[model samples]
Target: MSNQEENINLPLVHKGKVRNVYDFNGNYLIVASDRISAFDWVIPTLIPNKGKVLHKLSMFWFDFVKDIVPNHIITGNFEEFPAELKKYEYLRDRSMIVKKANRVDIECIIRGYLAGSGWKEYQKSKTVCGIKLPDGLQESSKLPQPIFTPSSKEENGKHDENISFEETVKRTGKDTAEKLQELSISLYKKVADYALTKGIILADTKLEFGFYDGHLILIDEIFTPDSSRFWEVEKYAQGVSQDSLDKQYVRDYLEKIKWDKSSPAPELPKDIVEKTLEKYTDAYEKLTGRKF
Candidate 1:
């Protein structure tokens, strides 16, 4: 519910595309609203409970993936949250109180399947992010294995440009880039495999990492629909676009409507919003094996 607004009462630190980060002394309180964005533009409407779905799902992963790498999450528990924020019951499940990290400026992406821009790139050049792929791979085709594909993290309203492994080294130094590459792929592989048990195909996901107390820790949201493509296992097919439990559905609707992805993005229809909510909630329940 925060754009670029700065109010003295809130001590807002940064407002990204969908998250409002408030500086809570040394720590930070990140609040995700029900804002749904597509084509890099926040649409005209909001989806009820969308933020909670994302927030809770991320909390589940922070704990689930901690053995791979430590994270920035302090707690999403209401009692453990800051005293000032505890008064609002709505924020209890939808807000995360996290430790501040020296934010990394890279998007650590890992792809286990051909989809989205990767599919488009492969169709024309038989490559993705400058990496050559085998011949005859179709859309949504599984990769030989998970590949690390890092991108330059862009500022709000700017598109992130995919960069090569060499470029990642140049931007963040060889040592840090290597860590990001190793950690991203390992986490993706582990989680992608685990997701299969939940009856979901983890096509790929984006992650952000940063230095916390001299240790590289995973930061930002991990494995949420907004960050990952969650395809239903039964609906997956090699040559066809798989049914997704993610924001891809919204993008599909937008594509069908032929809406120019400029400002004044069209408001999503009620059915579209309802379907998205169902997908989000379903993903949460299945992945966590807990009631949403």
Candidate 2:
């Protein structure tokens, strides 16, 4: 992303990994940037048009699932944008005005397959976040059924720690915990089933919930490549890591180079950036059935 955003007139409320959120009167303006992060470090280089790709894909999924759950989006229309963003032509499709809500502090993650932290924990204990699985599960192996794994919401630099289901009930009330877990799994199943028709496997994804108007609402990005592990369906196999179309593409490259994953990450090569864009674009197109 460019430094041009400094000239925009808005009260920046939160600067996340790839999205810069600003307060919009009673709402919020989330601007998706081309910034790519690997190992929790936002890289020095960017994939072209990545911001719009992610933002557009998120918009698509939000509409597709709005019937299943309430979301925070107001509209992506420029006409509905506040006067502050009216003069900023660059904030067109990459930005959205959303109603702000009292955010739930728990990270609601649902896993349909063994990968990432779930895989690591399963490798040692045959369980994921205290949820036991059948024996003989391998890396990239699909779980017998989807499972809810809750985690604590951490600061930008800190890793999110997984907590057991019982512990989640302790943190959030038992009712809220049950609601989150049930909603998360249902949402995951719906999206995962849709992705299968598109020839993409929705391995797992995280959802953030917030209480709005005394009800739970889904917030933040949903099922985008940035927030989910998407593997090409044709290449998926048990006992082997599958080729992916999400940020895992960049993670794999970073792992290969052994960059130590600390702050001030090494610059990405031009080819890497191009490949990353290809994956992100492909995911958007496949999921939404629209040209990226």
Candidate 3:
């Protein structure tokens, strides 16, 4: 079924690049779509089964980290869904029912490697998010330790701007800011260590948090290819962009074509879409030890 047309009779709360959120009894139903985005633009083509891979991987990670932090998930199992939602069989493996929380407007980014915007920033100032790093670091070099770099989370069609730690403190106040840093680092360390055991490098990940009844809880997707950079340990290299099992492949393809960012995004070739789905599926299987 085409996710774009599968209207669930629920009140639409948000329609993001790759997910649609619905209001359900004071809660939210987040449906991961087959849609993919790169270079901040939503690609015209959809990757088959991409949404299921993301949903399942997120379920795995949420369960894995429940001991470390409370999350907004109420349930992801379709059979357990409220009776009213049962007719939408399409949501079975691609949707999650979660508590409604006041979303924190900051992107809680934890970088354990020199890559992406962090690498670009480091090349110029030897610092990422204003956190000075040791000199001589390469493109994909691992940092001495993970650092909490926060960003202002913008709405769809906008870019998230990285901010300093002090800026985070000013925005969130001292206590909430410190708590976000502590939880973000702890979550990264635990998951990165686990990913290494499965022969994948959890390069860096972006996290989101929200306030639930006056308490901070993890919200949004965690550790999925769309939210994290996953590289095969076998292909690890320094000073160069490592082959990644994530949407970085899509980003690379877009870069190679030299598509100017201002124009409407172009449709991806068949091969590109298939290969992109493969990378996401591979990450899901490798990390979850289950067939995608």
The lDDT values for all models are 0.88, 0.89, 0.92
Clashing pairs in 3: none
**Better-scoring candidate (TM-score), 1 or 2:** 2
lDDT of model number 3: 0.92
State candidate 3's TM-score.
Answer: 0.97
RMSD of each: 2.0, 1.3, 1.2
Q: Cα lDDT of model 2 overall?
A: 0.89
> Total backbone clashes of model 2?
0
- lDDT-wise, the better of 2 and 3 is 3
Return the TM-score for candidate 2, rounded to 2 decimals: 0.96
Model 2 residue 104 CA deviation (Å) reads: 0.6
Alpha-carbon runs more than 4 Å astray in model 1: 2-8
lDDT of 3 by residue, 94-183 (tens): 999999989989999999999999999999999998999999999999999999989998896788899988998899999999999999
Q: Give residue 190's lDDT in candidate 2 (0 to 100).
A: 92
TM-score, structure 1 vs. true = 0.96
Q: Say which prediction, candidate 1 or candidate 3, comes out ahead on lDDT.
A: 3
The order by descending lDDT is 3, 2, 1
Candidate 1 clash pair list? none
Model 2 weakest lDDT span, ten residues long: 1-10
**Candidate 3 segments whose C-alpha is farther than 4 A from its true place:** 1-6
lDDT of 1 by residue, 97-195 (tens): 888999889999999999999999999999999999999999999999888888888886788899999999998999999999999999998899899
